[model samples]
Target: MKILPYHPSVLAQAQLVDLINYCQNTEAHLAIKMAEQADIFAIPQVYQQSGGNFWIAQDAQQIVGCIALLPLDAHTGVLKKFFTYPPYRGQPVRLGAQLFDQLLNFAQQHDFTRLVLDTPAAETRSHTFYEHHGFRRITPNELAVAYSYPDRHSWLYELQL
Candidate 1:
C-alpha cells in the first residue's frame, strides 16, 4: 500500500463520511468514564488545519487507512485518528510503522525530535502497537490538556527521533 499525506480534494466525500462513521462507531461505546478520551473532535479538525500533515494508505487509488499528526510544539507532535478500514485490517503492522517512520522523517527534516500520542486504557492492541514501535509509556498524574479525555485514563507515549 502507498501511504502519503492527505490532500483535501484527494479523498472523496464518501470516505470522509465513512471516517466520521468509523470514529463514532469506534469511540461511541466506551463507558462514560472512558468517553472523554474518545471524544477528540480536533482529530477531523487536524485535516482542516493540515498543520502537521495527515497520511492515508491508498491501494489501487482507494483509501484503505489513515493517520493524522498534530504538532503540539516544534519538537513534539501528537499522533491521532489512526485507522485502517475493516476490510484491510490485520497484521501488516508495517503499514502503521511505515506511516510513523514517515512522520518521524518529516519531524526530523523540520527539526523536531519527539513524537507523542495518547491511547485509551481499554485498547490493548494499540498499546502493543506502540510498544512494538519502540515507544515508551509515560507515568504522570496529570495529562496535557489536549491529551486528557473525560471518561478514560489516557496512556501517554513518547518516541525520541
Candidate 2:
C-alpha cells in the first residue's frame, strides 16, 4: 500500500464515500454524527484551505483507507475521516498504523503542539489505538474554541506532540 497526499479526485472518488459508509454501517445505530455530510465534497476547503491536509492509503488500484488533518488553530489540529477498509486494518497489513504515522509526522513537521480527535464511543478499537499512541481522554471543555466536533457525543482524545 502507498500513502499519497493531496488528490483532486478526493471529491470524485466513490471509494472514499464507500469507505466512510462502511465504517458508519458498522455502528449505524450509534449517536455518531457529522456536522455536514456535504463537507466531504469540500475537503480542500474545509481542511487544506485551513493549512491542513488529507491523505489516502491505496493498495495497488484500490483505496484501502484515508485520513484528514484539520487545523484547529496555530498549535492544534483535529483528525477527521479516519477510516480503514476492514480487511486491511491490522496484523501484517498495519495500514492504520502507517496512516497514523503519516498524521503524526505531518503534525510534528507543521509545528503543531497538540492533536485532538473524537471517536464514536462504540469504536473501542479506535479508542485503544489512540491511547496506544499516547493520546489521553479529555473532556470537551478541555478543547479549544476552534475545536468543533461533528460527533456530539464522542470519546475525545488528545496527544501533545
Candidate 3:
C-alpha cells in the first residue's frame, strides 16, 4: 500500500465518498448523512486550500483508506474523515495507521502544536485508536468554539504534539 497526497480531479471527490460509504456499511455507528457533511463535501475549500491537506491510501487494487487535516488555526489542525476500508481496517495491512502517520507527519512539519478530532460515542473502536495514539478525552467545552464538528454532541479528543 502507498499513501499519497490528494490531487484534485474530477474523480477525487467521488473516490472519497465511495470509501466513506464502504466504511459506513460495516461500521453502523458511522451513519453519516452525506448531505449534512459540509466539510467533507467541500474538501478543497475546507482542507486543501485552507492551510490543510488530504491524503489517500491506495494499493495496486484501489483506494483503501483516507485521512485529512483541517487547520483550525496556526497552532492546531483538526483531523477529519479518517476511514479505512473494512478489509484493510486492522493489522497486517495497517492502512488506518499509515494514513494516521501521514497526517501526523504533515502536522509536525507544518508546526501544528496539537491535533483534535471528535467521534460519536458509539464509535468505541475509533475512540480507542485515538487514545492509543496519545489523544486524551476532552469535554466539548474544552474544545475551541471556532470549529464545528459534524457531531457536536460527540466525544472529543485532543493530542498535544
Candidate 4:
C-alpha cells in the first residue's frame, strides 16, 4: 500500500467520498445525522479552508484508508477523518498505523505543538489505538472551544508534541 497526500481533483475527491461513506455506513453504523455532518464529501475544500491537509492510503490504486490534520491554531491541530478499511486494520496489514504515523510526522514537520482528536465514545478499538500512540484522554472542556463539531458524547484525546 502507498500513502499519498490528497489532491484537490475530481478523481481524488470521488475516491475519498467513496472510502469515507463506505466506512461510515458499514463499519461505523453512524446515525444519519452524524454521518451527514461528518462532511466527508467536502474534504478538499475543508482542508483548504482550514489550511490543513488530507491524506489517503491506497492498495493497488484503490483508496483503503484516509486521515486529515486540520489546523486549529498556530500551535495546535485537530486530527480528523481517520479510518482504515476493515481488512487492513490489524496485524500484517496495519494500514491505520501507517496512516497515523504519517499524520504525526506531518504534524511535527509543520511545527504543531499539540494534536487533538475526537472519536465516538463506543469506538473502543480506536481509543486503544490512540492511547497506544501516545494520546491521552482529555475532558471535552480541554478541547478548544472553537471545535464544536463533535457531539457531547464524543471522547477527546490529545498528544503533546
Candidate 5:
C-alpha cells in the first residue's frame, strides 16, 4: 500500500467519490442524502484554494483510504473526509493510523495550533479512535462559530498542536 498526496484530476476525484460513498452508504448505513454534496467532487480545488491538502491511501491502483485538512484559519484546521475502505479497516496494516499520523505531521509543519473534526454521533468506534489519538471531545456549541454545519447529533473533537 502507498500513501500519497491527492493530485487534482478527474480520475482522482472519481476515486474519492467512490470511496466516500461506499463507506458512508454500505458501511455506515448513512442516508443517501447524507452522501450527496458538491464538495465531494471538488476535493483538490476546495482544499488547495484554502491552503490545505487532501491525501489518499492506495493498494495497487485502488484508493482504500482518504483524509483532508481544510484551513479554518491561520491557527486552526478542520479535518474532513476521513475514511478507510472496509477491507483495510481494523487490520494489522493500520491504514487509518498511518493517514492520521500523516495529517498530524502536515498540521504541525503548517504551524496549525488546533485541529477539529466532526463525526456522526453514532460512530462510537470513530470516537474511540480519536480519543486514543489525543483528540478530546467538545460540545458542538463549543466549536468555532465558523464550523456551523455540525448537526445537533454530531460529535466534535479537537486536538491542540
Candidate 6:
C-alpha cells in the first residue's frame, strides 16, 4: 500500500459514507456530525499553519485508508480519521503504526509532546489498535457537545509523543 497527501474531503467522504452504509446494514446510527465536517474543513488551514496534515493510502489505484492530524495544543495534538478498508484489516499493525509514526514525526518536528484521540466506547478493535501503539485509556466522557448525540458517546485515548 502507498500513502500520499490527500485532502480529507476528497476521498474521506466516500470512506465515511461507506462506513455509514455499513453501519446501516447492522442497524447503527447514520447521522453525520459537525465535528467531522469541521475537521474536513480545517485540514487545509491546518496544513497552511502547521497544525494538521491529512494522508490517503492506496492499494493499486483505490484509496484504501486515510489519517489526519490536528493540534490540541502548542505541545500536543490529536490524530483523527485513521481508517483502512475492511479487506485490508488483517494486515499487521504496521499500517496503523506507520501512519501514526508519520503523525508523531510531524509532531516531533513541530515540537508537540502529546497527542489525544477518541474512539467509540464499544469499538474494541480500535481500542486494541490504539493500545498496541502505546495509547492509554482515559476516563470515558460523554462528548455530548462535540458529538452532540445522546447515543454516540465516545471513550477518550491519549498517546505521549
Which candidate order results from sorting by TM-score in descending order? 5, 3, 2, 4, 6, 1
| For model 5, the run of ten residues with the poorest summed lDDT | 31-40
| Per-residue accuracy of model 6 over 1-161 as CA lDDT, tens digit each | 88777655656656644543453334334354545455445666765356677776767767666677776557767777777656666556456666767777877898887777876676778889888879887753621123221334677877777
lDDT of 1 by residue, 1-161 (tens): 78877665635434744654564466444433223433233444654364577777887777767776777776777776676665565565456666667777777887767777877777777889899888899765433435443336778788878
Relative to the true structure, candidate 4 reaches a TM of 0.89
Candidate 1's displacement at residue 1, Å, is: 2.7
Q: Which regions of candidate 2 deviate over 4 angstroms?
A: 10-12, 26-35
RMSD of 5: 1.7
Q: Could you report the Cα RMSD, in angstroms, for every candidate shown?
A: 4.4, 2.2, 1.7, 2.1, 1.7, 4.5
Local distance difference test, each candidate: 0.65, 0.82, 0.84, 0.82, 0.84, 0.65
Best by TM-score: 5
lDDT of 4 by residue, 47-129 (tens): 74677788889889788899999888888889988978789999998899999889889889889999999888888899999
3 or 4, greater by lDDT: 3
Report the error of model 6 at residue 129, Å. 0.8
Query: Taking the tens digit of each residue's C-alpha lDDT, what string does model 2 give over 51-80?
Result: 889888988867889998998889999988
After superposition, which runs of candidate 5 have C-alpha atoms over 4 Å from their true positions? 150-152
In the predicted model 3, the residue pairs found to clash are none
State the TM-score for model 5. Answer: 0.92
Give residue 93's lDDT in candidate 6 (0 to 100).
Answer: 40
Deviation in Å, model 6, residue 117 alpha carbon: 0.5
lDDT of 3 by residue, 6-96 (tens): 8766676787778887676545546666787777677778789999998988877477789999998999999988998778878788888
Model 4 Cα shift for residue 150 (angstroms): 2.9
The alpha-carbon deviation from the true structure for residue 89 of candidate 3, after best TM-score superposition, in angstroms, is 2.1
For residues 25-123, write the lDDT of model 5, one tens digit per residue: 887887655445666667667886788888899899888899989998898899888999867877688899999988889999999999999888888
Show where candidate 1 strays beyond 4 Å.
Answer: 10-13, 23-51, 86-93, 141-151
